[model samples]
Target: MPTYKQFPLADTAEGLTEADILSWHVKPGDTVAVNQIVVEIETAKAAVELPIPWAGVVTELHVEPGQTVEVGTPILTIDVDPDGAAAPAPAATPAPASSAPAEEEEMKPLVGYGSKAVVTQRRARKGAAPAPAPAAAVAAPPAPAPAPAAPRGGYVPLAKPPVRKLAKDLGVDLHALTGTADGGVITREDVERAANGTPVAAPTVDSGTRERRVPIKGVRKMTAAAMVQSAYTAPHVTEFLTIDVTPMMEFREKLKKSREFAGIKVTPLTFAAKAVCLAAKRTPDINAVWDEEAQEIVYKDYVHLGIAAATPRGLIVPKIRDADSMSLKELAESLTQLTETARAGKTTPADMANGTFTISNIGVFGIDTGTPIINPGESAILALGSIRDTPWVVDGELRVRKVMQLSLSFDHRVIDGQQGSEFLADVGALLADPAMAMTY
Candidate 1:
């Protein structure tokens, strides 16, 4: 007899209740080994690949890709007794008057993880008749409308779990909407079009397409929630300063050419990050968080500096741990790795958590400056503006120099104007003279 086993969705992390199945590596009837990576799932924080615990032949896939399943739900089933010989087929015989009750077996859960017992009941023998439906239920009135025809191959339309949920909430049928995404994968925009009574085959670039509806989830969703919470809860005070950063730019170019920093792409942001880290020590309050419930100021001894990175998913801030202790080269290398990891969507939850300070380099986007909202649990965020050639007075002589604007947004509850201005000025002074950081 073949032993059927179920694979439940394990709790990958604390507070994570569900995950969206991004893709499956194996299908039914495929042989798999123990600890083999079987599927990839995307939680709110990161994408994780799950492994099978026992070697076996895959029997069934209970959940489909792009579906969000809760912890303890069975994702796949396997047959552990694949090596066992098949039993001989039974001969046709006269049916007995009655049969014994089916036996149920409880599946063992994965080690260190607990899940609800998945009971598998034996199927009735082929000759056994199904129990009759209740006569009163059979006589019930028909539904007002005829049931919609099931799609071919029991096809549930391909869509991300969020899109499916959106379609459900908007009273739109996903099966009826044609997907614009690759491989006929339905998107949030498709569901929105259906909800708005727009044609499913309508071109996205058409002038009459009007508005686009984007589903807020993943990093974008988390960022929005955090921004809203920070904006309403913390009294934000923004201060702007325009300074000549010609020296910082020159320092970066010199470092790029030096053999000590050869092959490393040094940018002005590197100097800005170093300046912020050094200046934060002078104004420790800027690196602290306001504890509303405790009514106390929580100051951190170390800085897990968050560098805001914009990815295809959305804006994500992956922090560099212990940035204050790192040398200029170390900081540069860490920043490079952090940014690459963030853009690749491989940034883990631990990388993003426990940020004491943040730097949003908007100069990369060529925008001058804007008031940046504080990251939740952090007191201040520095915004680096575009660097451009501007006329400036140098020793009573008008000269064209590379000037940049810096905007600092701080929580008024934690940092007053005097301390905030001083902190911003310290950072500016360091950029104006790179050697100023050595003194700190």
Candidate 2:
């Protein structure tokens, strides 16, 4: 008997309810082994690859790419006993007892459930026969040509998952364009060019309908909900401070050429991160969370610092766990890795949870400071503005100095105006003078 198994979408993270199918690695009639990656899905936090637990021939894919599915919903089906009794008469013959262990090993349980036993011996196809002799060789009639293979009407374009997703998002037809990459693979630039060349037919001089609509789902939907909740629930208080950071900028340049900080990214954000961690020691309220159900303020000793990153999917904040304990070099490396991972859409839900404080580096966009909403579960958020040279008074005379702005937004319910001001001032002071960290 052929045993058919359905693979459901499991919760990849805690409290995960649903996900969108990003892509499928296998198609119907493809053979797959246990622990083989068969599909990729995008949850609220990150994109995750799912392995099929059964070693079998794929029978069907239940969902298409970009389709959203709830947890426990079947996404694929496989026939674990593809060479079993359902095949030709010879396939029904029982295998020798000695081969049982091999079957068991091939069908080993994964995650929790065990699939059907694997059949090692492949049965011959029905009606298969030896070829006849050629007319020139044996003076007999030539063998008829083999039947043509079934037409593969569904031609999948050669592109990476990210490129495919980008094409889909831009409404670009991948099949219409020629790939310029090696092996004729599609690249991100190819998709963008195609999108740019596409004609827009909806907009006209007479028609008032010119807006495009996109369904809010996945990370974008989750971020929107979080921002709304945090904005309405937490009474936000924002404070701004502009400071001359020439000393810190000079220190950064010196460290970059030094042996201790070689190959490390010691940017203004890195300084801001270290400042926030050190400042939190004196003003712990900046790292605390409000417990609405318990009616108490929860304070944390360790810092899980979150750096706000803007990615193609959406804005995500991945945390550096226990950041306060790390030295300057360690913090720089951690920040570099965190930003890269978040931008690549690989930041897991666990990395985004339990954050103590957040730093939004809006300065990267070349903009000055703006009031930023605090991330959910965190007490305060800081926005770092662009650094530029400005005239500043030193002792008695004016001189050109690197100046930047810092904006801090805090939950007034848990953090008073004084605590917020002190925290912001401490961070600004550290940036204004790197040696101030030694005093902390």
Q: For residues 6-106, write the lDDT of model 2, one tens digit per residue.
A: 67677664577788899999998999998999998988877777898779898777667876676655567677888875443343454454333111122
Mind giving the per-residue lDDT tens digits that candidate 1 earns over 97-170?
34322223455665544454444333233575643333333432111122246666787887765676688789
Clashing pairs in 1: none
Question: What TM-score, over all chains together, does every model reach?
Answer: 0.76, 0.74
Worst 10 residues of 2 by lDDT: 139-148
Query: In terms of TM-score, which candidate is strongest?
Result: 1
Candidate 2 CA-lDDT value: 0.79
lDDT of 2 at 214: 61
Q: List candidate 1 segments past 4 Å from native.
A: 85-150, 153-208
Error of 2 at 89 (Å): 16
User: Best lDDT goes to which candidate?
Assistant: 1
User: Which regions in candidate 2 have their CA more than 4 angstroms from the true location?
Assistant: 85-209
Per-candidate clash tally: 0, 0
